[model samples]
Every structure is written in C-alpha cells, then in structure tokens.
Target: MLCLTGPTRAVTIDPPVLLAPMEGITDRIFRSLIAPHGGLGAAVSEFIRITVAPTPQRVCRRDLGPPIGVPVALQLMTPDDSHLAASVANAERAGAAWVDLNFGCPAPVVFSKCAGSALLAHPERIARIVATAAAATGLPVTAKMRAGISSPAHLRELVAAAAEAGAAAITLHARLRITSYDEPATWAWLAEARDALARCARPVPLIGNGGIETAADIVRMRAETGVDAVMVGRAALADPFIFRTAAGGPAPTVAEASAWALGYLDAIGSGSPKAKQLVRYWRCAGMLADPAQRQALLRGPTPAIAGFFTSLVPAGPAPPATRTSG
Candidate 1:
C-alpha cells in the first residue's frame, strides 16, 4: 500500500495505480462499473467546478458517491480560491477521502476561464487555492498539474507551491499545455519534479501520469522517475482490467470480457447511447478484428449489440474473482 501523508490526513492507496478523472467519463456509474474489476488504488472524480458560487453539498455527495470499496478523491477546479473552502467543506461532508486540485486540464473552455491548466502559468495562485482547501477540510488535499503552460520554465515553482501549501500529494502529467496528447510524455520531467518534491519540507508523494498504456509502462515509469505512484487515464477505457493486468494477474478470458460488457450494458440500461460509445472503446470489441464487421455489430440496436456480446461468451461457468468485496 502507498500512503500519502500530510499534517492532518493520511490516505493508504493500495496497488498504487489510480484511475485518472476524465471529464464526460469516469462518472459515478462508470467508477462503480470498473470498481468490481481489480487493480485500482483509487479513483478520482471528474473536477467539480466551484465558480461563481460554492457547489451544493448534494452535488458533492453525488460526485463523490458513497465511500465504499475504492476510495474516491473529489477533484475541484476554479479560477481562484473564491469558493474553494466552501466546496471543500461540502466534499468532506460528502465523504471524499481526499481532494485534488486541477491544474492539468487543457480544454480551451476551462483554460479560457482561467481555470485548469491556465493556473499552471501562475504558481502563486495554485498555492493560494491549495492552501484554502487544505485549511477548510481535514481531508488530504492534492494537486494535479502538467509540466507548465508553454514551457517547463516554472515547473519547479509549481511543484514547490503546492507542496509548501500543505498538499498531501501531487500528480504530474509530464507535458506542457501546448503539447498535444500524441506527443511523448517527458519522463525526464517526472524525474525533475521528483527531485524538486524531495527538497520540500514535508516531501509529499508524487504521482506520474500521461502516456502510460501498459503494465510494462507502469514499471518503467517507477524505475525511471521514482514516482510514488502511477495514474492511468484513457488506457482504462480500452482495458478495464488494466489494473489487474499491471498487478501481474491473469488476463480476463473472452468469457470474462463478454460478461463484463454485458454487465456494463445492464448497468447503463439497454439501448443506451453511452453504452454504444463506451463499448466501442473496450478491447473486447476489438476482438471482432474486421472494422466493417465490428461497426455492423456496434451500430445495431442495443438488443442486437447485447446479443452480440452474449455470443462472445462461450457457454460455461461464470468467471471467478472478477469482483473484490471491497
């Protein structure tokens, strides 16, 4: 287990691999659906914006979900610290294990609002926002950031600001905001940030994110950068069993994959547009091999698609150890 400790809070994140919070994805239902599959240390909520006013407590509770099984960290994004403390209090009451500040999102809308990665250009603002959240809640406060805005010139200051402001842990995405997602993440930057955090008075954990797609990548990242943990984002969309695979567990069989797809469909309800979109991303669907044939099945009505997934499952006893009680 990896423990992220700060002055007033400590969170034990087992497996040391987390699910990156993706906007428009990784919602409560998505998290619940993936939780049964093993290998997650924790799952982060998509950032809950605290803009002109504090987010209501019910919204925080819905975003955080019930604190069962995998611990969920509520992520917050804002241009300034205006409603940070109030939002943090709502998160605490909502049962968030920890809180994460967003400084890595590259969306133009968020950046235009002076939120998300826009804050990467202002290290002092990040410090103030983090400090506000830290003081408002006993829950461990963390920060997620990219290397910088246009360059890595102020990367050290960004890391130092969050750490000095009492952040329990910091996750570095290892790419400048101007860089495209297709560009290779700079592992050297992770190493640089690791070195910077080591110089902090408290030395909070550093989580390496971006461009990690396989179990081998996870191992290589830790060996190369000395990050305390790793976080997986888009990769999990393709392979829900990624965490288990990274932990050296057996890969899910075709039958197991079929079962999961079918279960996911059931959870989202039959004929859901969401299921159609997300199903296209699953590795199991890739089993179809032929693009034309795959599209034929994927585009069909929900019932037909469900039947196709069911056909993939050979008649047999159900898979074992698919879900953890926790």
Candidate 2:
C-alpha cells in the first residue's frame, strides 16, 4: 500500500481499485454519486484534449474543479509533449491530486489526429510522453495503454518504455485498439503485461482493466494476474455498489441507492434544459433506481423530471430488467 498526503488528508490505496476516466461517463455528477459507496481508491477525470490554442478558464473550471471528497486524478490526451505538460501543470494548479496519461482511447477521430491509441505504434514516444508528464507534474503520474499495437511483442515494449519513463503506475486494458467491446478481453494478455512489469523491477503499481464486472471478477483477476489493482469501467455504470461489495461493505438497499442517484441529479441542478437532457440520458441508461419513476419524472418539463428523479426513493431494488451488466 502506498500512502500519499494531499492538501486535505492522507490517502492510502492498497491494491488500488480505480474508476476509469471514461468520457461522457465519469463527470462530476457521477463521481459524486459513486464516491460514497466506498472501495474505489481513485477516480480519474475525463480526458482533456490539449491543443496548441490557449485553454479557456471555464474549460479548466469544468474539468479540473475541486476534489469530489475522494482522490481524483486528472487525465489528458495530446500528441504534443509540451502541450500535455502545460495542461498537466494547469490541472495541478486547479486542484488535481494526480495525473493520468491517456494512450488507450480507441476512438477513430482521436487516433486520426495522432492522439490516444495511435501513440501505441511509437513506444519511444510513449516513454517520452510519460517522462514529460511525470517531470511536469510532481504528483504521481500514471498511464493507461492498450494490450499492444498489432502483436503481443509490442505490448512488452510499451510496458518496458512506460517503466523506463518513471510512471508511478500503469494500466493495461487487455485488448488492442482495433478490438471492439463485443470481443471478450484477453485475460491471459493482461497476465502477460503484469509479468512484464514485474520483470522490469519498477516499483510502480500495475493495474489490470477490461472484462471485470463483479466483485468476484476482481478477486479472480487479482488471483490470476497478481496485479496491484483492477479497474472497473462499464460495470461501475451498471452498479456503483460494486465498489462497496468489493470492499466487503453492506450493499446499499435499492431505495438507498436510488436516493443517492437522485441526490446526484439534484446536485447537477435541473433548472436548465441541457442539464435535464443529461439526467434523462442517465435515467434511460438505467442509472436511476427506478425506471418507471424516472419516466414519470420526465413526463413534465425538464425541471419536473429533475425534481422527480432527485426526490425518488423506492423501497427495494427496481424491477428486474431483461438485461443487466454490472
């Protein structure tokens, strides 16, 4: 276990289980909703794309706001080393407890611009990027990378370079960029990455990602790979309580969980149509405790929906759905 002291208190993460910084998913609203569930050691900010143009203050405010009562790491994606370093500094100034370099995003638009997973093809560049960001931000710097470029050999090189770059930690998503969500994650590959990191003798922690859904899955992965941590992404969206379960805490009653979700929507405010739209999307995606209640909330104007979802608290788990994944 590593203990890091922040401005407010000391934060300890042992075999750290983290929340992935997924775009459009882990915003302030969601982070606040899930933080209280307990088990997660860190929540990463959504990837902030750094550009040659000057960053707007509001952009920083929106992305790098105050910590959500939990250790929050800011993530940045950019092809330029200097630009990323500057962005990391700005995030630190804005109150980021840690920094994450995103080299695992597989979006075609991102790769087309030579950002994100495209950097996987250049292990040397990946090392340079990690070195630059780590040097720029005195805080712990981590990197998230894909399994490899086109072959498993590439992943070995990637892990070696990241270790050489002084990364405080590294996470492998267990699949190549071209592999879509439909395919099962290659658990063996993740094991290989862990072994590679171990052989390097770097003291940095290694985290495994991809295909983890339940607490059982986490336990299995840790036992199999001997990694320092496991990251939960879509599974968290399905059930924020997974963290609690992983930590061996009592699961929140359905009503209690619903109330928490409502509180999150309330925090975001329902006064604006845009805010309402975001809430509605979250509701339809089964984020709310009660699906029927969420629909009824949307019956009136946007504000009404916000009010309803915010005030809802059913007595038990919502009706079983045809499909569920967390």
Candidate 3:
C-alpha cells in the first residue's frame, strides 16, 4: 500500500492504483467488488452533483453491504463555491476517506453548467474551488482535471494553481475538451504537468488517467509519465483482474474472471450499470462466443448471463486468490 501523506489526511493506498469514476458505473457496489480482488489502491465515487440544495448522503455502512477494501473518495462536481464546500463537508460526515473535485469530466451535459472542463477556461476559479474544499473539511482534498479546455498547453498553469491551492494530488486525463476517445491520450502532457509540479518544488502527487487498456499499459503509464499513480478506466471494466495482474498479483483463470465479473454484476443489484457492460467485458477479454450464443448472452435474462459466464470455465483448479476480500 502507498500512503499519501497530505497535510491533514494520510491515506494508505495499496498498489498505488485508482479506479476512474464512471458516471453510470463506479457506484457503491462496483467499488466493493473490485477493491478486494487486488491492486486497487483507491477509488472515487461517480461524480455527485453539488447543487444549491443538499442531496441525500450515501455512506458505506458495514451491515447493509460489503465493505469496500480501499480508501474511498467521494467526488463532487459543481461550479458553485458554497455548494462545493458544503458537499465536501457532507462527504466527511458520510465517512469518505477523501473529497475529490471533478474538473476533468468532458460530458457536454456537465460542461453546459460551467462545471467540469468548462472551468478549465478559468484556472484561478479552479484553484479557488480546491482551496474552498480543503478549508471546508479536514478530509484530504484532491482534484481531477484534463490537460486543458481547448489546448493542452494550458495545463501547466492549472497544475500550478491546484498545487498552490493545496490539492493533496492531481489526476490528469490527457485529452483536450474538444477531443473524444477517438483521439489518443497524450502521455507527454502528463509528464509536462508532473514536471511543472517538480519545478515548483512541490511534492504534490500526480495521477495519470486515460488510454490504458492492458496490463502493459499500466506499466507504461507509470514508467513514461513519472506519475505517482494511475487510474484504470474502461479497461478495468473489461478485465476486472487487470489491476491485480498489473500489480504482480496472481493471474486469474477463466473461471476466476467469470466469477469476479458475476460477483460484480450481482452486487450491482439492478440499475445504472446495465448488464450490457458485461458483454463489452467479454469482448474485451477476447472471449467472444458464436453469434447466436453472444446474442443470447447479451440479450437474454440475467440468469442466462450468469450461466454463460459460468460455462466458460470447465472443471479446473481455483485461480489465484485476490489479496483482499469483501
């Protein structure tokens, strides 16, 4: 486990890896299933909108559900100063290990409200919001941002601003606002941001995100960017064991992968994270069945999905154990 020793909160993060929060995914159940299997250092919740009115708080209670195995960060995305501060304090009350400000979400719906990447147009305001959250609660305050709003060149200034405002760490997703996943993430941009922090003599950590799809990509992210940590995105959903495998944890067998994926779906209950994501997961893991079989698995009942996954594994020895457990 890697310990992030911020001024107020010192969080122990195992394997120095993080899960990038996905809007519909990355809910309570998703965090529970992944952290225990290995190599999950920490995870942030899906971005919670901090509006003019306070929303109901969601906490991880021991009796109601499985405990997430890593430091849990509650993420807040908003353009309102008071709302941001208030939400951070509420997250502290909800037992969040840290509070994360989301300035990196590129969704047009989010940006339309002057939040997310839209704030990149005003770097000083970004600094102000981070400073507000840090002051509002004793909880560790971190920020996730993109390279820039329109151009990657603007990241240097924003990185410096976040550091000066006492963000415990910064996560940089290497894409401009206008770009989509169709454009490749520029790892050089992350290096540039890290170097900027270094030049300032600030030991603030940088977490790199985007464009990772394999175990080797995880290694490359840390090696090339000089980042303190990395967040796995769609790739993690595709292969739940990628974190464990990349961290030198045991390689999961076919049965184990299916088990982990099934466990994740079951924990999800019903809603938000549709079971269709599992179809993509199967494809990503190169486990495509025949056309009729794939259609049946994807479109049939939930029980069928489970049966299909289970069928992938014949009678074999159990896979390597995950380092931790729910």
Misplaced by over 4 Å in model 2 are 2-11, 54-58, 201-203, 268-326
Selected candidate, larger lDDT, 1 vs 2? 1
TM-score (C-alpha) between model 3 and the true structure: 0.88
RMSD values for the candidates in order, in angstroms, are 4.9, 8.5, 5.5
How well does candidate 1 score on lDDT at residue 96?
85
The residue ranges of model 3 lying beyond 4 angstroms of the native Cα positions read 55-66, 269-273, 283-285, 289-303, 315-326
lDDT by residue (80-191, candidate 3, tens digit) is 5866666676777777888889998888888999999899988889999989888988777889999998798778999889888888889899888888876899999999
lDDT of 2 at 226: 82
By the TM-score metric, which is better: model 1 or model 2? 1
Q: Is candidate 1 or candidate 3 better by lDDT?
A: 1
* Candidates arranged by TM-score, highest first: 1, 3, 2
Highest-scoring model, TM-score: 1
Candidate 1, residues 1-326, lDDT tens digits: the string is: 67876457788999899999998678888788777777889999999888789988899898877655988999999999998889998988888888999999899999999999999988999999999989998789999999999999898889999999989999999899999988999989999999999998868889999898776788789999999999988778777777888888777787787888788778878867877676566664245557776688776776787887789788887678677686
Backbone atom clashes (below 3 Å) for every candidate: 1, 0, 1
Residue clash pairs of candidate 1? 69-326
